[model samples]
Target: MDYSHVRGVDPAVADALEGEVDRQQNTLAMIASENHVSEAVMQAQGSALTNKYAEGYPGERYYAGCEFANDVELLAIDRAKELWGAEHVNVQPHSGTQANMGVYLAMLDPGDKILSLELSHGGHLSHGHPANFTGKTYDVEQYEVDPETGYIDYETLAEQAEAFDPDIVVSGYSAYPRAVDWERIQDVAESVDAYHLADIAHITGLVAAGVHPSPVGVADFVTGSTHKTIRAGRGGIIMCGEEHAKAIDNAVFPGAQGGPLMHNVAGKAVGFNEALQPEFTEYAERTVANARALADTFSQHGLEVVSGGTDNHLVLVDLRPSHPDTTGKDVEEALEEAGIVLNANTVPGETRSAFNPSGIRAGTPALTTRGFDEEATREVGELIVRIVDDYDDQETIDAVAEDVQALCDAHPLYD
Candidate 1:
């Protein structure tokens, strides 16, 4: 994708667009929720399907001129079903949060109770942060990971579910590193006679690649982002049993969303087709391997690695024990200056404000997408530790910045 046409029409907007492309080409993207999609997926996302207004599902539309739109959506849905092994799949949602919203609308009435993990403990806002509709519309209670181990306290969660007796129990997380025990969580939800909705927004690709335990069959509803680890175009997906298919489709169409982004649906189809290839499994495996290498590097350097290590594509590093005075924000800014882009994250049993949390979260999905292996990831990890160890050291920052550029060049995204 060339933005030359855009540059001819609108220079300023084209400049920013090209700058973003250059940024990705030149920098290391370690953000856990991000990945680099193929140029095929990009082309599809930027296709003419964006002009269509497909207001309903395939074979049934509320508008005319949707024959090709129907084909695109059906293809996306069919590929998604194969990818996640769901009896039913909805590919219409504009984002992961909307996918969750679709499930919520289908299953729970307003004012019903919701039990989910705390955001500070690695949960997402859609899982019931007070600011999101999940908290405001429903009665929300939170479960937490064990302070010492940085793992979910399943027994406590079960006990709390029995006590709170929520209508739905939400598992999965935004920053969790360890593999989730979906069956265990489902047992808790079953004991409380509650529905289990596992939000795998961060690990869609891992689940599809068989690199992580899937929640599709274990939970009553499984929601995910199409983009994160899935490397699909930016959208949301829901997987559920055949019994709930109608309700979910209705909830997504009439209840929550209007017209689906057909262009994004095309991208999802292309990406899912790519995922079904054998190389995608290799990519997923390499992603997890890189994360392990990153965790080992951080742990060896005396940083507190939450849950000790990772079984997935991300690692959480608590800065407290290693550098008690430094905040995650400080390291985030320093690393960004050095062109190693990731995010500050809140740790389990967090003592500081969420804005300036005590931890940094790193992931290897994007790096792995750029063809980085465990060895290359370890080098990146070593560079991160050095910067976090001395965030203000300009000489060290400059050196790391140069190295980051070299790594980016080595694994050129656009090329």
Candidate 2:
């Protein structure tokens, strides 16, 4: 963790780097899309492979002296295949969004139709938000979760799919909590002669550990991040059957990006190896159990838990019903001051702007990695409720900060 070499060259940047380590060690990280990677993975990502410029897949490189690069990438691909049971996997995209872009490029031409969940309802921007390239390039339509139950209405989605007749049907979500029936969505896409792309970026680890349903063999294409719940390298991955493998490979290489980040690919190989152990299954199960405990604690306090609970690692809490005057941004800032860190998110049927939405999203991935169980997670949830109930009270914030520090000390990170 020492940055002495960096300090010798650039003290300012080194100070910032060291400060970030201190921050993560002190505060609770409840951001649903984040996790703590092992120092082994970090070392791999910071290795000499970062300088390599391998522009093609293994055994066919666009540059010389790429033997080590090929070895790392091949290991990543093999480990990913074993982890997810994917027939074919591409671990080259720089991010999850780029993986989605690769799929879009490989399958559809410009102005093709795309049907995905609406962003405020738990969909990602790459799916079809106006601010992103996908919205500008394609004709996009969106589906929604049932307003009353906070779950995807498959029948309604099928009806919309039949009517819209999109080129691709996008399943999976960023915030919606219940298990998705991938078969139902696949059937809907098949009925309309459309391809199905399942974006499981947030639940990649859960799916790999058999804690959540997977879309590898069921969907035409699957995309995920290596970081989130997977706790791997900071990168994206794409998986498909052999029939579409060549197209995906080409789209990701010459179509979207040039050179692969070999250092990150090495990190992926190391982390995937770590995930294959028996301990990872236990980790995944505990992550979901901790989330359920957090949601139950929220419900006992009269806070509205989206979908009434969670099946995975995150719980979405809508504050509109219980605390009508409090914005999500208000609670998020106050919690940060209390040494708890999560994000403001838009809930289904959102009545406010995205910047200051009505909901807060919390997850147990980082805390679980730090050895937290159900009891500790519930205690954290109670602390969150305290902040939500009296966010502006400085004395309450101070008390919660002390409690959060105690928790951090008990579950020491990077020790």
Candidate 3:
């Protein structure tokens, strides 16, 4: 059962896998949409179903011998529906971006207008980034938060929606610290007769746990990754209201992608079942608690967190004041040397480019799942502050690596 051990694979790939596992166990993972899956989820993903070529949806496969695959897909769909109260669930999209694409393909025509959050303001690239297919194919109108408050301005969003009269209004984010107002988005979309798509990929687990409001009941379509806070296999799912159910399913199968990964679907089923447990609600609460703990630490160190602080699992640290001369990229590399994993992000309408940004983003969902509580988050935050402050010194970086290892060792993964 020691699947984490990497003793008998191709040396190059094995070495890389082992190295990744070692890095994970030694460092702290704070990426907002990332987490370590349970051993059971992992096992399910790597199961024999991967070898089977079950093209198309469950029973109506292009190929034969898909009886078991049908059961797996049904389980994933049923469990996800039960957990999130979705009328229809599609467990076929390979990733969140793909899931969103499926929804777009199902509902909109080419050149149709899509109103979404600006990418720099915590929105995903798939939403409307110029270089992405969505931007190239559809007319994009983006909205952002108030520059001073660092929160979405519903009035501005409504104005933009009216001006654009978009076919779809996207409501979601990747790096935003607070909860989005789904009702406001729904109202705006309704006023314009646009479909409301809630990309609740980051906070899906919280929504399922009732810690955050579920957009399933209000939004026309909802897309989420099963792996992030849900702690499932690496895949995406799209949930929607009853009216769009059949269209969404057909779009995912015959339109966008051909086959569903049955094994990953099985893993998703397990993850959804786990989320349905009472303990998952407790875990979600701890995730928020840990985020707050880290946010306090960042504030103590004089780093400005966007929206004052986080209302969820991720916190966006504005390192502008902390290191006026340094960039977010510089701080990110320095922190990586100290065995802390995070991403550099851009504030809304930021002057910096994507390669090197002005902000650092971290989260608590992964660490909290590893059994890290408020005290541990504080320690990790202290490490982050120390690394950022002493980034210029090689000796300090080395010392912090030792500290990171010590903390990681204290909570060894899967041991």
> lDDT per residue, candidate 1, 1-415, as tens digits?
5899999999999999999999999999999999999999999999999999989888889999999999888888899989889999999999999999999999999999999999999999999999999989999999999989999989999999999999999999999999999999999999999999999999999999999999988999999999989999889999999999999999999899899999999999999999999999999999999999999999989999999999998999888887999999999999999999999999988889999999999989999998999899999999998899889999989999999999988888986
Q: Give the TM-score of candidate 1.
A: 0.99
lDDT of 2 by residue, 155-266 (tens): 9999999999999999988898888899999999999999999999999999999999999899999999999999999999999999999999999999999999999999
Error of 3 at 6 (Å): 7.6
**Which ranges in model 1 have alpha carbons more than 4 Å from their true place?**
none
Q: Candidate 1 — worst ten consecutive residues by lDDT sum?
A: 406-415
Q: How far is each candidate from the true structure, as Cα RMSD in Å? A: 0.7, 0.5, 1.5
Candidate maximizing lDDT: 2
TM-score of each: 0.99, 1.00, 0.97
lDDT of 1: 0.94
**lDDT of candidates 1 onward, in order:** 0.94, 0.96, 0.88
Clashes of each: 0, 0, 0
Cα RMSD of predicted structure 1? 0.7
Higher-lDDT candidate of 1 and 2: 2
